[model samples]
Target: MPFGKVPVLEIDGKVLNQSTAITRYLSKKAGLAGSDDWESLLIDIAVDNIHDLRQEIASYFYDPNEVTREAKYAPLINETIPFYMDKFEKTVEENNGYFVNGKLSWADLFFVAILSYLNSSVKIDLLEGRPKLRALKEQVLAVPQIKAWVAKRPTDIP
Candidate 1:
């Protein structure tokens, strides 16, 4: 609870925090993680990048000043989002619609998680000019289990 975060997990009497770590652990448990060290490393890289992107978005959300928020929004719309999203789209395309090595790693799941938050919280269609990312989003959300989870979740953004 250092940052008062809610992703704190209790596994086998051991406590763990941080979303990325928790996700990684669960992904491995569910057989959704990478198949080898190299692939796992790639997944880590992708997850870290997503974390930074989410932080940038969070900074804008937490800013109380309209002028500052607007200033940040412009770059996010025209630069930051495109830069990250474009790279993500390319990676997904190269990996056959997945984030890592043509397989379903935690990277793909993290992409969807952050993508959904960005869509709802920022209310921006970040996927507008990115066809691959759009397709990836559709693919991720179409998973039977993910679809069921989304359907039962609250409608509110936050």
Candidate 2:
């Protein structure tokens, strides 16, 4: 009943119940998706991946089944993290050592979030030997605005 109904894009009369679609549209309109198609795709991938992983993590936290808990997080602790480390390293190296589009992009932000997850949740050195990954994390955090935001993010967003 807020807004007296669903929020509508009155300019063209588009209606969406979901927040993701609306944000994507606003992103395009605001020039934040970037100047080119690859850049926009990179942004989409990063945003979608964030949604995917965070959902899994939420389930990991709330799953009442022990088997489900182990299954949900074991791959996170053992496999997926290492996979991301290797994959992101190679992607950075092959893409001239930039996260996306030969420059820092939302993909890097995803990397940072993943790193933060690992740092906050895992005791193991999941990022060990991944200097490039380390550098990438540092690079993203070195941005003053992002640094402040990271500081503001909760330790347990699970």
Which candidate ranks first by TM-score, i.e. highest? 1
Q: lDDT per residue, candidate 1, 132-157, as tens digits?
A: 87888788889899999989988884
- Residue pairs with colliding backbones in model 2 are none
lDDT of 2 by residue, 1-158 (tens): 22565544544554444555665676567555657887888777766755665565566666889898877787776766666557767767766656666676656655575665655554566458877767777887897887897689887652
Question: Candidate 2 local accuracy as lDDT?
Answer: 0.65
User: How far is each candidate from the true structure, as Cα RMSD in Å?
Assistant: 2.0, 5.2
Cα-lDDT of candidate 1? 0.83
Best by lDDT: 1
- Return the TM-score for candidate 1, rounded to 2 decimals: 0.88
Reference-based lDDT, residue 85, model 2: 59
